[model samples]
Target: MLYGAMKVSVGAGLKVVFRPRVEGREHVPARGPAILASNHLSFSDSFFLPAVLDRKVTFIAKAEYFTSPGVKGRLTAAFFRGVGQLPVDRSGARGAGEAAVRSGLEVLERGELFGIYPEGTRSPDGRLYRGRPGGLARVALASGAPVIPVAMIGTDEVQPPGKLVPKVLRPGIRFGEPLDFARYRGMEGDRFILRSVTDQVMYAIMRLSGQEYVDVYATVAKRQLAEEARARKRKSAQE
Candidate 1:
């Protein structure tokens, strides 16, 4: 009920104001379980993709969004739930990854579309980072669903991090053809197969988004950048 209402109200407002350019929407299956694997560029990537899709796409959000206290917290949690977001505790990396896979499989079993960011986190920079093989690959192989590569173009420019208001510029969404990994269906337990499947999906996203490919994980890139900044600060202090 709330999902339909929000889709009509918020989705309509977004289309009117931003006028997002969407393409290849036909690539999405009309009624079946499929994975929408996308490159994570901005916070708004989650909102814009679901708004434009006719079918509901369920994504995992951090548990804090659902567990915070106070009136504002409750309202925020309600909003996220209304939009079909499931909360997962992300404090432990291994546990979180396993939980996410479980959540995704459950959604797929219901014959619903499950949306995921293969990169695990948003790109610290605009470049495409390597996909984590554990969650996305496991769910794809386990559920045997077609993986659709989605590109959210110019979303970083429209709503960069820490920006209160988005710029009134057009963002684009391109859906690539669905990829099937049926040959590797029963090999989800194999680490090598997992990495191979994940790399294939990342390659498709890179082609669609036209972002520079970074072979490292986004979290590693973020840590390296932070270390560089601290090193510069230390050098300046010593000078």
Candidate 2:
């Protein structure tokens, strides 16, 4: 109820004011288990999807957002929990993939919506990087749920890196047709097969978003860049 309502109200407002257009909304199931596979561009990408979606799609958030220690923490926790966000430890300590897959499948079994960023992390340079066959394929295979490919474009401009507050820039969301791996129905636990399915879903998102696609995971590139920048700064200071 809150998810659908927020999506309609906020999404409509953005459309009227900022002219952010959303396509393929019909792809969203009115009720039933489904996966929202999208490209990770901006943090606002998380906010905007629920605001515009008709169904309540529950997202898994970072542990910090749910574990903060004050008024801000309380507010953040309340807001995220209210919006149906769950926190999962992404540090991948133990049984990381299995844990997330279990959580996602449980939600699907309960006939609820689950959201995932296939790229695993945000695109470092505003480009759609490769997909990590994270438990997404497992969840889909386990629940037989259709993965809905979503693309959020220009949200980076709305909330760029290092920005404390969001600027009122136009943002657009496009939902591609839901991807079903019915063909691979009995093939769970096959890493190679799961990766192939993920690639097809990601290709759909890349086409919808028009961002250049990188063959490697987005986070890997971001980490390397950060290291290189730090090294360059150190050398410059010495010079």
Candidate 3:
């Protein structure tokens, strides 16, 4: 209700000035369980995609959002939840990946749509990073749901980093066909197997969207810097 209504009113108004062209919306399933996997470009991409998507797609969100302090935090949390976001900590214990996959699987098992950013986090470089494979393979193998590869062009320019408000700019969303991974269904849990399936899905997105691929997990690179920061703090305390 809130999503569709907001999209209709706000989206229409926005389009009058800065129109956003959407393509391949037929790719999104009108109903049933499917994965809307997209490349992470900008923060606004979250609201933008959901606004354009006809269905009530649920995306995996960080758990910290819910626990945020003060009124501002409360509003932010409310809006995200109101828009159908599920909380899952992506930076906690080693089991974070498994937990998120499990959450998404639960949604699928209930015959609901699940959304995920395969790259794990936003791409600072505008280049699609190598996905973590995070349970995408296992989930597909388990649920038998079709994966819809989505690509958002001009989003980065619409709302770049360090900008609070979106520039009165317009960007477009180009959705691709839903891809079936039934051929690899019978394959065992081999790393190579998972990587191949992930790449194939990403390739579909890459072809439709035409973004540069990074071949490295965005989370892994962030993890390195985070670890270094922690180590530095520890050394400072000890010295």
Candidate 4:
């Protein structure tokens, strides 16, 4: 299979180059469906997490990664497909979250691993952000899959924002014990239950990652940080 071949080739090289240190891999079920809820730190989080796992962990990616213009776009699409990424249109449609939940539920229905970043986006400042209580909780409760809190360490340092070449450093991954929310099953429609489940999973990730917890969403934090940078620049120009 293409997935196996790509994983072997790329995963082998990644191990040789980055030499990532993985812990509690046994926390992952040897069989059956599970949700890998991880803190979003770096773009490489997608590749690195899959590379180290024995089973394929499919993540819902933006549709743009699959559809674009030119040769680079084609290659990007191919790579994402080769690695088993499911694309969902995220262009301000209310259905975007619904589509992602559907995709995740489908993957779980097949009894496979489904990976999700509860933070919704990469941490703007290397700190853990509040988990979005939408797709993650909906899919988990609907499918009754065990949610595993995974932590990726040092990935940002190895591959920081806008960096072309990754630094040679030993990143780490830690998998916490599965957080079972079976009690919340059939209650996915309850917003309060969704928030509770998402918060519990986020707390587990925070403990495993040891990153400072921010009570805000990553997107809001990113925007505020950008505004602060612009204000500083304007002040400097005026001076």
Which of 1 and 3 is ahead in lDDT?
1
Better of 1 and 3 by TM-score: 1
Q: How many clashing residue pairs appear in each of the predictions shown?
A: 0, 2, 0, 0
Residue pairs whose backbone atoms clash in candidate 2: 7-51, 7-52
Candidate 1: C-alpha lDDT = 0.94
User: Could you tell me every candidate's TM-score relative to the true structure?
Assistant: 0.97, 0.91, 0.84, 0.98
Which ranges of candidate 3 are over 4 A from the true structure?
1-18, 186-188, 220-239
Over 129-202, each residue of candidate 1 has an lDDT whose tens digit, in order, gives: 99999999999999999999999999999999778799999999999999999899989999999999999999
Output the better candidate (2/4) by TM-score. Answer: 4
- What's the lDDT of the predicted structure labeled candidate 4? 0.93
Tens digits of per-residue lDDT, candidate 2, 1-239, equal: 65455566665776566666778889899999999999988887877887676667788888789999999998888777767788887677356666678889888988988988988878889998988786778788778999998999888888887786878877888988888898887687798988998899889999899989889988789999999999999999999
As a TM-score, model 2 comes out at: 0.91
**lDDT tens digits, residues 1-239, model 3?**
76566566655566665577889988787888998888888887777777776667778788888879999999878777767787877676557877887888898998887888878788877888887675676677667789988888888888887787777777878888888887777562677888887888888888878888877788776787679889999999999
Sort every candidate by TM-score, greatest first.
4, 1, 2, 3
What candidate 1 gets wrong by more than 4 Å, as runs, is 236-239
**Best lDDT goes to which candidate?**
1
Error of 1 at 171 (Å): 0.8
Quote the lDDT for 7 in model 3: 62
Model 4 Cα lDDT, one tens digit per residue, 1-239? 87788788888889899999999999999889999999988888888999888999899999999998899999889888878799999987568899999999999999999999999999988999999999899999999999999999999999998787889999999999999999989999999999999999999999999999999999999999999999999999999
Model 3 clashing residue pairs (backbone)? none
